[model samples]
Target: MSLRANLVLATCTACVLVLGAVPGTAGVAQAHAVLPKPVAYPARGQLAHQQAMDDGACYGWARQQTGVDPSRIASAPVPVIVPGGERVVGAARGAAAGAVVGAIGGDAGDGAATGAAVGAVAGGIAHRQHRRQAAALSAQMQSSNDWALSSYWQAWTACMTGRGYSVQ
Candidate 1:
């Protein structure tokens, strides 16, 4: 095979691999969250009603003061584990390349099949490593976001406490 043919084969293989690896966003499921129950305040009669009103007002005020969206409190983001697409693409490409090389030995089909299997395993390993790195970064980002959220929660709780409602 000419150098041009080899380059074309390599290019096509790479294109297939890259395109296959891209993730699709359609049909993603939304996560459901269980919100914390409201704290019960001790009060009686007319005082109980007043306390209820206070709790309602204070909760709203705290949310606004802390700039925390209620929806965010309801639903936290979940990280997704991506499936590898590179394995199939790699195997296909490897087989094509192998066959071309094996043509000189008059056993192109056997060489292609063997090459494909090896390429697939290598691709799977590469995919695993990529996912590991992505998961680590995702965890770090989640930790940072959790800290910020906790800071907001603390501030909100403080505001409610200052409003004369015993906050737990």
Candidate 2:
């Protein structure tokens, strides 16, 4: 597969792995497959069996229209909080680099101190930026998930209603 395909596949796999399935549910997809349960009545006096058939047809259409498989929504990945060590690592690296420079000029200790401080500040800034990005990504994903679900249910409801069911 191409790089983009590989990345997409990997990300989806990660989502399933990290989030797992919702609890107290049976089977694989069932664990997370929570479709909107709008109370629907057969207004056109359709038979119970016919209602079931319409329900199945509408469900398929809804999935096709929205591309939001309820089965996969629950597996949406939450970003893992990686343990922070950027500042310390940055400080150490900066000190080492600074020490070399300082030794060429005069005092290694003073150079190391200046380097460490500068490195720590830079690292701290980088860390903050990372956190912000993670937060933004998480919010965006949630918004997307919400939209997908709403859109799917709306489509599904519309389908059922069109098929002579009084869908709520």
- Scored by lDDT, the top model is 2
Cα error of candidate 2 at position 12, Å: 40
Model 1 residue 164 distance off true place after TM-score fit, in angstroms = 2.0
Q: Local distance difference test, per candidate?
A: 0.60, 0.66
- Give me the runs in candidate 1 sitting further than 4 Å from their true place: 1-65, 79-81
* Clash totals, every prediction: 0, 0
lDDT of the structure predicted as candidate 2? 0.66
* Per-prediction TM-score to the true structure, in the order listed: 0.62, 0.63
Query: TM-score of the candidate numbered 2?
Result: 0.63
- Give residue 43's lDDT in candidate 2 (0 to 100): 100
| Candidate 1 TM-score, true structure as reference | 0.62
